[model samples]
Structures are given as structure tokens and as C-alpha cells.
Target chain A: MQADYVNPIFKAANDVFNSMLQLEVSRGDLETNDNLVSTKEANISIGVTGDLNGSILFSFPEDMVLDIVEGMSGMEMKEIDTFVTSAMGELANIICGNALTTLNENNYNCDIVPPQVLIGKGQTVAMSTEQVLTINLETDIGEFDLNISIS
Target chain B: MIWKERYKIGVEEVDRQHKELFNRLNDFLQVVRSEEDMEKKAAEIEKTLNFMGEYVVVHFDSEEEIQREYNYPDYEEHRQTHERFKQEIMEFKQEFEADKCNEELVMEFSGKLLTWLIHHVAGADQKIGEYVDNN
Candidate 1:
């Protein structure tokens, strides 16, 4: 993926974290992964279509997922249940949606499908292509990964 | 309690509606997460859903009107998002009416609502505030 494409995703993640979650996020070095795998317990995959075609995967650790839900709802959650998973999926959806807007401003008209959540360990996602860009996002609650593969 | 000062978009009317939405959603979530049995919660759930369904439409309309008045460039896109959310809520209402005692559905709905409200106000709607400030 081009730096142009990746920057929007980073900006979106930073903006969403700061505004919605009220948390500061600092990004680590970007790296490439051979295949898409759930490095964390909760994974949300969002499909992008139109100007760009492929999916973005957001992998969140179990503790981070619970922390985000707790932060958003002010209620304690101990497990990765349906409610937790749904909220995680929406978080990915929001990030992708904002990225699409940024892409549009740059003349890349695109739209995103609703987010799909996968929960479990050792689950793998079949990439549409060979390489995926991965970024580690460190937030006050915890850390999560953003895997991007779009042509 | 879900309403936060940080979520304000700087547009007075829109910010007011957002707070109302958060208040309504907070009430709905409390009942959904409560330990009360579904039978006992059904009436309150139905009432909250009704208020949410109607109030969302009102809020979206008022917010969209502000966008139009300011000649917001992304008005159509913003309106489309509101339309999609309204459809989802309508579907949920229909499902709830068909099965009034489904605690699982209520739980799912509450989770989705909480996430959607936060992102919409803080992410998408904030752009509108930026535009207003710049203009």
C-alpha cells in the first residue's frame, strides 16, 4: 500500500480515539505481514469497495475490548460477549467510515460495508492479496492492531 | 451520563440534540442491562425504543437543516448516514414488536446504539463543526 493510502487510516484512528474514546493514541512503526491472522482475541473486518477494493482488519486484545466497552458505557464488562463484540465491530466501522471520507476528499470515492467480527484464538483471514500492512496503535486503554490490505 | 462535554460539535442546536440522544440512550441501556426479568422490563423497553425511534428522526432533521443552511459540502453524505441509521432503528423496532421479551435483541441493540452515537457525534459530526468554525 502507498503511504498516501496508509496515512488516512492512521489519521482516522487517531481522530476517533481522541474524540470518541477521549484517549491519546501514538502509533508504532508500520510493518508488513504475510497473511491476516487474529493476533488478538477480537477481530473486526471491514470491506471497502469502489475506488479501493479489499478489507481492513482491526484486531483488539480481549482486555482492550473490555476496556473500550467500559469506557464507552461506563459499565464493567468481564468477557467478550455479543455486546462487546458488536461494540468492537462498530468501532472498526467508524474508523473505516472516517477513512473513506478522507479518501473522498482526495478524489477517491469509496464506500464501506458493515463490519464483520471474529472472536477466538488462532483464527486466520485469507487475504485477497499477498501483503498486508500492519500498524500497532498504543492507547491509554491498551494496544490494538490495524491490518490494511487494499489495492 | 453517556453525554460528554467533549462530544459537543459547537453548533448549539446540534449539540443540544446530541445530549438528548445520549440521555435517551443511557436510559435505554440501563434498562437493558438491568437484572430485571424481560417480562418486567418489556414495558419500559418498548417505551424507550419508541422515544428513541421518534427522537432520532427529529434530531437528524434538525442537524441536517443546519448542514444545509451552512452550505455544508458533505450534506448529502451526512444525510445518507442518518438515513441508514434510521433504517436500522426501524428494523430493530419491528423486531422488538414481534418479540417483545427478547433480552438478547435488546442487549445487541443497546451495544450497537452506544457505539454508533459515540462515533457519529465525535467523528463525523465534528467535521461539520470544523467547517462552521472555518467559515
Candidate 2:
């Protein structure tokens, strides 16, 4: 996808992490994804419609998933259970919603469907054949990747 | 979960309702997560669920009223999100009333509620504050 479509997602991720999770995110390397499988333990996939027609995949490591749930709930989260996975999915949902809002400002006018949370590494997710751009993001808790395959 | 000062959207009534929503949800979560027997917690859980489902509607109405008052640019989009969440709450309430509510469903509901509130307040709701300030 063009930077015009991709940058909003990155910015929204950083903003949500900062404001909601009380953490700073440092952007890491960017690469292209040839495989449609997630390497991280928790994969949150959200569909986009309207101006964008593909899906957004947010893959988070197990530790980061636990960290995020614990941070938000103020309770100790030891494992990636339903509670943890659901929270992670909602996080992805919020990020995508905000990104679409930004895209609307640019006249892209997109909307996101409810997020689907997939647990376990190497999970295959449905995505478009369009070029998939993966951007690595680092936080004090852990690292994750944002995969954008929207056309 | 505790409501942080940062979650405020600069609108007094809306922020108050948000804090109340957090407090109520935190209580409901505590009941859901308690070590007590499931049968014993059933009545309390149902009561809280009813309160939450109704309170959310009232709060959304008030928030939407404010948005209309300020001519919030994203009023329709924002209201649509609220409608979706209200429908979710209704589904959960129906499940609970239908005797299908279990630990898994309760856990899932709590998790979604927690994350949804935080993000909506800190992200979407903040836009309302910004719009009012700018105008």
C-alpha cells in the first residue's frame, strides 16, 4: 500500500499505546510479508471496507499481550487466556478505528469491522494478495508487528 | 479499573459518567473474577449486568446530546459505535438471562468492556474535547 494509507495506521498505533497503555513506542524496521501467517503468539485481524478493501493484522508476542491486558485491567495477567486475547483484539480494533478516522481526513473514507483474535504462533490469517507491508514496533513491554495488506 | 485523569475529555458531565462507568465495570469485574461459587454469584452478576446495560444507554444518550450541542463533526460515526456496543451488551444480557452465561463468556465480556472503554475514552472521546476546544 502507499505510505498515505500506511502511515495513519502507524501513527494511530503509537497514539493508542501512548494514551491508553501509557507507553512510548519506537518504530523499528519495515519489511514486506510474503507469508500470510503470523509468527507472534497473538494475532488480531480486522477487516476494512469502503475505500480500503483488505485486512489489517496486528501480531503481538505473548509477553506483550499479557503486559497490555495487565496494564489496562490493573490485574496480574499470567497467560494468554480468553480475557487476554479479547483485550488484545479490542486494542487492535481501537487502533484500526482511529486509523480509519485519519484516513477519512485524507478522503480515504474507510471503516473497520469487529476484530477477530487468533491465539498461537504460526496462525494463518486471510489477507489480500496485494503487497503486504510489515512494520515492527518496539515498546518497553515487548515488540510486535503491524501488517498492512490493504489495497 | 481505575479511571485516570488523562481519560477526561474536557466535558464535565461526560467525564463524570465515564468515571461512574469505570467504577461500575470494575465492581462487576470483581464479582466476575471472585473465588466464590458460580451459583452464589449468579444473582449479583445478573443485577450488575442489568445495571450496566441500562446505564450505558443513559450515558450514551447524554454524551450524544453533548456532541449534538457542540455540533461534533463525527456525531453520526460516534453514535454508530455506541449503538454497536449497546447491541453487544444486550446480547450478553440475553445470554446471562438465558442461563448460558459461563465463566468463559463472563471473562470475554469483561475483557472486551475494559479495553473498549479505555480506548474509546482516550482515543475517540478525546477528539470531542479537541473539537470543542478548537471551536
Clashes of 1: 0
Best by TM-score: 1
lDDT of 1 at A87: 82
Residue A98 shift from truth in candidate 1, angstroms? 2.0
B18-95 per-residue lDDT for model 2 (tens digits): 988888887787787777887888888888878877788999999999889989989999999999999989888888
Best-performing candidate as measured by lDDT: 1
Residues B1-135, candidate 1: write the lDDT tens digits.
578898898999888999998888888888787789999999998998788778999999999998999999999989999999999999998999999998878877888889988888887899999999999
Measured with C-alpha atoms, the lDDT of residue A44 in candidate 2 is 91
TM-score of chain B of 2: 0.95
